[model samples]
Each structure stands twice: as C-alpha cells, then as structure tokens.
Target: MLVLWEIYPWRNVEVKKSVLVVLVVALTLIFPLNVFASVQIQRPVYVEGKRIAFDISPIVEKGTTLVQIRPLYEALGLTLSFDPKTREVKGGNDKYEVVLTLGSDLAKVNGKEHKLELAPRTIKGHTMVPLRFVAESVGNSVYVNTDTKRIFIGVFMTYLKDKYFDMSWGLSKEEVSKINKNDHNELLYENNKFLFYDTEFSLASKKNMVPANKIYSFEGNKLSGAIVKFNSSDDFDEQYSTYTQVIYDLNNLYRTSSIYPYDKYWIEGDSIERAYREVYKDDRMKMYEMAVRSGDLVFICPFDFADTELALFLQNKGTFSKPEYEVSIMYEQNKEFFNQISN
Candidate 1:
C-alpha cells in the first residue's frame, strides 16, 4: 500500500507538507529564547543625602501624595451621625450640624459658614470630610508617617513642620531617633527658609537621619529638598527612563545612590563624552557661585568635577576657562586622548 501510495505524486507532496507544518510549529515554540536576551529590569528610586542612602523599592504603597481624614467629635467622646440623604453630619448632644457640600471646597460647621481646600465626599456610602481643615476645625491632628506607613490621628500638637529636626551625618538610627524623641525643639533653617522633609521616611533604613536632615536642610550656600526617587520596573530598562517618568509626574530630579567616589577617570578605557552645552556652571567654585546666585541644586558625578572631563571638553571647545592648574594640564591630556580615541 505504501509503495502504491508513493507512486502517486500527490501523496509525496501531501506528506512533505505535513512534515513542514510540524517543524514550523516546533520552531515557533522554541525561537523566543534568543529574542528575550536583551530584556532589562527597571531601576529603583534611591534617596540619598549627606547622612542617609536607601533604595525606594518594593513599595508597600505607591502614590505621589496621600491624604487622611479624621473624625473630630468621636475622638472627643461625643456622639456623631451622618445623614446620606441630606449630606449632613451631626455631632454631640448639642446637635451641632456640619454640612459639607460635595465638589466644592467649602463646608458649614454648626450652621456657620466654613471652607476647605478640598471638598467633602461620600465614599463607600459614608460621608467623608476634608482632612486638613476639618480636622483643624474640630481640634484634632493628623500626621503622615512615611517610615511606619501610617496616618496618625489624635489630639496631636506637634505639626509636621514643627518637627524641624536634622538628620546628622554618619549617625546610627538609634542616635537619630533619640534626638527626634527629645524635646530639643531646635529650628533647622537654610537659605532663609524653614526646612521641611519627612523624618520617618528618611530614617527608615538607617536608625538615624540626622546627617540626611542636615544635608537636605542646612546647606551653606545652596538648599536642596526631597524631590523624588527614581526607579525602573520589570516593564522597562535604563535608570534614565524611570527618572523621566518620575520627573513628568513630580517635576523634580530623581535621587539615586550612584556615587562618584573618586574624582579621576582612567583615560585609556573610559569613553570620552562632550560636556552638556547648557552647563549651569564652569567649575566647582563657579558652580558654588552659580548655586548661590540662583539658589539651585546642581547634580554632579565625582568624575565630572574631579577628573579632567569638564576641563578637557572645555579646552577643546574653547568656550570657557577655569582657574585650576590641574584642570588645564588634564585638559591637555584629555584633548590628546579624545583625538587619539576618535582615530
């Protein structure tokens, strides 16, 4: 039967077609391995300061901002009730009625007029009030603890701004916490403004955030604040890409742990890159001066300032000059290296 079938030319063609179909399917199942090799992992946002460094990843909760609501009458040992039909909240035996209108940044407390920065709303069938102003009106306090990941509400007196404590450099967590708990009541200031940062978030990895506080708040000539952390996800590769996303949302630089510990770069193997045309400053002193004049924070890798990258690039372009002797000599060497590497 097989020999007879082979005699039919159509049979040979049909058998070959079946074999080709099986091979194609088999290869299709196995061919994705090499194509997936270039896949990358997203980088994580890192918060770094003079005294603190930590990677902000594996976030328990992820949001740019957080808001919490507090009930006033209930905390004061008084009865409270809300009427969904009327959009009214009643407190205590006095029947003090507080009316909150949805979609408007205003409220009426005890039949008198009141206002809010954000409006009240009904969530999960319960009337929710604006957090900040409402709580203040009713004599309660709310605090956001970034380290413990909690929103605290009680008869709290210490405002987040009042906890103007500094994280000292190179101190252990225990030392920093002790200071925070102390009644020192010191007002840390910089650039003629009161410094503000989340202490709990700062002290999460390290027991103490004094150094970080100091760096973040107490700049000699320039001031810096906690803009945001940068990270990549399983969805993307490259730290800069993650940073771009963060900047879009927060409009600030993403802090990282990448430290340029040394000021020198080896000329032999390092890739030569040109200076950014729109540099904010010419040299470290100039950077300091510019920062003072502008009061802006400047980002620097150790090599950009320490090595001859800036000087060499500047000399080749002849756009600016620096006063440092090492810069001029190194620029000469760097210029020679750049020419040699290109050829």
Candidate 2:
C-alpha cells in the first residue's frame, strides 16, 4: 500500500499535471473549440459568411440574380409554403411575410405590394425568384462581386476605402498592430507601408482566393491607402493570365479602367509572347511597364518605380523602393496619397 501510494499518479505533482494534460487533449480532440475567423468554405453563394449550396445552380436572367425559393427557405429563416391552386408562394417569419406569384414581377410583403427585379419562374421544376429583392425584404442585404461571380447575402461588403478584411481605413499603426485577421494568415512586411498578406482564399488552392501581398500605406500615422500586389515568378504566359484575372477582380470593385503606358515596348491587349518579344526586343534595356487605373483607386501591372520620375519622388520621400519581379499587378488606392505624386 505504501509503495502504491508513493507511485500513485495523482499523488505526484508532475504525474498529475501530465495526466491532466493528456485528458484535456483527449477531450479537446473529441470536442473541438470554435474560434472566430473568416469563412473558409468555398461556395457560389454565402449567407452571413456561411456557405449555402443550391441544388439547381443560381443564374442571372435579364441582369437579375435568380435563386431557388425552397433551399433559401431554411437558410434565410422563413416558413414557406407553395399554393398550387393560386400559383403563389407564401413565406414569412416574425418580422416579414412575402407572397410571390409565378410569372409576375410583383410581390406582397407584409401586406404591401412591392415590385421585383424579375418575376418568379419555374426552372427545372423549382420555383425561382429575384434573390436581391427577397433577401432585402427579409432584412438581409445582398452584395455581388462581378469578377468573382460570388453572391454575398446578409454580409456587409465594405467599400474599398472603408475596410479590408477586419482592418478599417484611418486606423493608426498602433491599432492595426492587433489586426482581427478574420482567418487570414499574416505575412512579413517589407516596407513599413506593406503589411504582408492574407493566406486563406489565398494561394492557388484558391479553394478560394489567389494569394497576394497587401500594402497598407499610412499618412500621419493613419491608414491612407490599401494596395494589393500580385506577382508570379513562374512562366511568363502564366503570369500574363494571372494578371488578366487580377485586373478583372479589381474591375469588379472599381467598374471602369484607363491605361497608362510608360515603357517603350508597351502594347495594349497584346499576348504574353508579344509582350515578351517587346520586352526583350533589345537586351540593351528590357523593361515592361504600364498602369490600368479606375479613378485614383486601381491596378498597376508591372509597376517598377525604379529609374522613373516616381522612383525619384519615392526615394526623396524614402517611402517606397522597387521590387524585383518577372510579372506583377498592383491594385492601389487613396486619392490623397496619389494626388501628391501621380500628377
């Protein structure tokens, strides 16, 4: 008894601690803790940051986003019932009730008639209605990224000037030092302005987004501009394709674009092979440069500030230096910052 008591696991402080740690680990494995982070599940549509997959894919008809009524019933939290006799679908929660009729571009919401973007129709034998209208009527806002072709319902899509990930514009360096991250992994910063990257929808796994470097420019210790730079040291052709998509992604937010060519070999809408041919046309100087802009906020492809007027300005300010890259695209921002030097 004395031997067993001396060797007893709980009787020993170290042994008791080890046993507690093992038990806690086992319990944790069985029941994992939920930590807040950006939604990683990839889907065509997201409701409140949660992925919702529809049986019949949603489509845009006449510029109106249409989705199945049945699947969204539970997702959006509404008690829905279809009436075959009147060819009307009735859905309601405590806040609002909606009545939709097939082939009619009008709906009854909370006893009030509201016009819909597109009339409800049967596609693949399932009832479809305008997603934006239905969602908004139920107190959920909807946002769509044209380039990504992803729909966000009940998620606030912050303006580029307002927010990026969990970080907001006008944040001080001290405030941003503790970023919410929102499931995105942080990368090392190069210049004090560039705050590295988010690595979830990041990388080719793109299981969602292509990884890109994010630069947060600060003026007077407050965030002034947020820039995203995409580059590939891989094949030139692949780089061209990636930049094309990157530009498209920027366009989805900014809408219009203007091209600015600086280098001599610049060609508009040319192939990678052609661009490569142009860049190496003379080994004396191999330079590829141009910028595609939408107002003050936009994208710069192959932006090399080195050996340019901008380079001199940046050097004078000691804010930016040239980065070596084979091919790249930088989505830039802030009228205040650009107004200083872009002229």
Candidate 3:
C-alpha cells in the first residue's frame, strides 16, 4: 500500500451590491487556511502494448507513470504490507519479508540485504517503482527495445507515439516498396480552395497513386515537393485560366519552392514587390531551401512593369514580348514559389 500527503491553498471571493438608484458594489477576496490531505491505496501500473503514454499535463501529477502492477505482482504471488508510521513496506511471502524504506534505495530481503538497481521515487507525491526489476525479480520477463522505443511484457508491446505519426520511425521493407510506388494521397483541400497555406501535409495510406511523385520515409510516400508553373501575365480572363491550371496541381505541391528570373521591369512598390516582402518574412524558409538545394524544377512569375527604376532593376530592354530582366538578390531565383503562386 502507498500513502501520500498533499497541501494546497484556497482563495474565496465575495461580491456585495446595494439596492439604490445608483448601486454601490463591493468585492472582497479571502485567503483560506491551507489543509493537508492524505490518501492510501494499492500501487497501480498501467500496461499498454509495448508503449506507455505518460500524461504530463496536470501540474499536480505531471509525468507520473500510471502503472499496472497486478500482473507482475500476482505472477510472483507476493504479499505486501505497509507501516504508515515509519513509511516502510514489507513484501514477498511468508518465506521472505523484503524491507524497503519509502524513499531509500536499500532493501533487505529477510534481513540478508539487497540493492535496488534503480531506486523507487515519488513523482508528484506518488510512489513509482521500476516495472522491469519488480517483474523480472518475480520471474516475469521484461524486454525493452531502445531502437523502437518500445517495451515488451509477456508478449505485449508498447511504444511511445504509437497513436501519433512520428517522422523518425522507420518503415518496413513492404512499406518502403509501397511508398516508392506512391500509393498514398496525403494532400487535402480546405474551403474548396487549392492555394491553401497550412502545413496539413500527409497522404492517405489507402489512396491509389502513381509512381511519378512518391516519397519513401517515415513521413509517408507522398510528393515531398514540386516546382509548379503559373503563367498569368496575359489578359485577366485568360490569366484566370492559367491560375486555375497552376493551382490544379496544388494538391501535388510538396515541400515546394519557386524560381523567378529577371523578366520585365515591375514597379518597386508593385503588388509583386509587396508579395515578395511579405513572403520573405514567412518562416517557412527551410522548406523552400530544401527544394532549391534538391535542384528541382522551379516555377517563375515574370513581372511585367513600366516603372523605370523597376525596369533598370530587371535590366529590361524597355520592350514587351517577354523582355529579359535581371534577377536581384531580393528575388532569389531559387525561392519565388509564393510570388509565383500569388501571380
């Protein structure tokens, strides 16, 4: 049995109002005396399949492991007794009584003496003991896998993040084959719009996909990213068609970045300039850098402007018909994806 004592502060609030044409209100806050609380209970251990998820949310008991002790204890048929006065525990069977201090690492089995490989400690005032030592000492097998971050007890496997997608987890050979084939569709559209800007990147493992853009990683076999083309400098109506066409493949853009070369002379304060400045502040730089470093095909949006300064900056010939402009450092040719997308 385990017992814990806790104390907490309490605050009281009171509000008073006077009845009149103009009412007066009074509020009083009071601090109450702190009280100590104690409780006694049998030890508990929670067993999940090779993985255990610890709830570290509550400040009172955060990071405390809710253990499952029955299977391990019953396997050895160990009888346990606790002395509340000295906070000591005696367990084992009639054949032996193991004496253990609540907070000490030393234990004596029938007075012969023994050592705890790891001392049992109180977390958030709850006594926690190592499951491995207790189980194995009682003839129950305990296996832990550091590689998979898993623990196995009596054919039960438990692992951290078993219910979540972990990017570092490795894939099996069959999973690798399936991923290489691009058999999943991880992209989803929100608000029925294609040019969304959130990182909801994932693939449905069950979706059928062709092999052109498949990624094989614990992340998933999805398109990691791609260069998309958006040509919209034409007539507004015709440009809309091009925009839709560019966004049609929006579902396939993975880790996408863009390239913009010198084309026409757009004004310094033009929408293109503004868009670029805004995107420069976006912290998704690493994704774009990854795309650029990969040397993937990049999409560009050539700005067509008549501003002389912009013209000189682009080094335009002061002519139309797709005049060649000079790409500036501010407009890195490797990462203009957002600008191209906006265009």
> Candidate 1, which segments miss by more than 4 Å at Cα?
1-73, 76-78, 83-85, 92-97, 157-343
Instruction: Note the Cα lDDT for every prediction shown.
Output: 0.28, 0.48, 0.30
Give TM per candidate.
Answer: 0.24, 0.40, 0.25
What's each prediction's clash count? 14, 3, 18
TM-score for candidate 3, please give it: 0.25
Local accuracy of candidate 3 as per-residue lDDT tens digits, 108-186: 7667667775445444544455555555444344433222222344411111121111111223434333332322333
Q: Write the per-residue lDDT of candidate 2 for residues 37-83, one digit (tens) a residue.
A: 21121226667545576877665645776787887877898899988
lDDT comparison, 2 vs 3, better candidate: 2
lDDT of 1 by residue, 1-343 (tens): 2222232222222111111111111111112232211111121211110111122111111122112123334444446665667655555435444556654556776667875644554333444444435544555444432222223334422211212223322233333334545342232432332232222222222344322122122122222121111111222122222223322321122122123311222222223212221353345444433322231222222111100111110111111232111111010012222232235
The window of 10 residues in a row where model 3 has the poorest summed lDDT is 1-10
How would the candidate models be sorted by lDDT, starting from the highest? 2, 3, 1
Best prediction by TM-score: 2
Cα lDDT for residue 275, model 1? 26
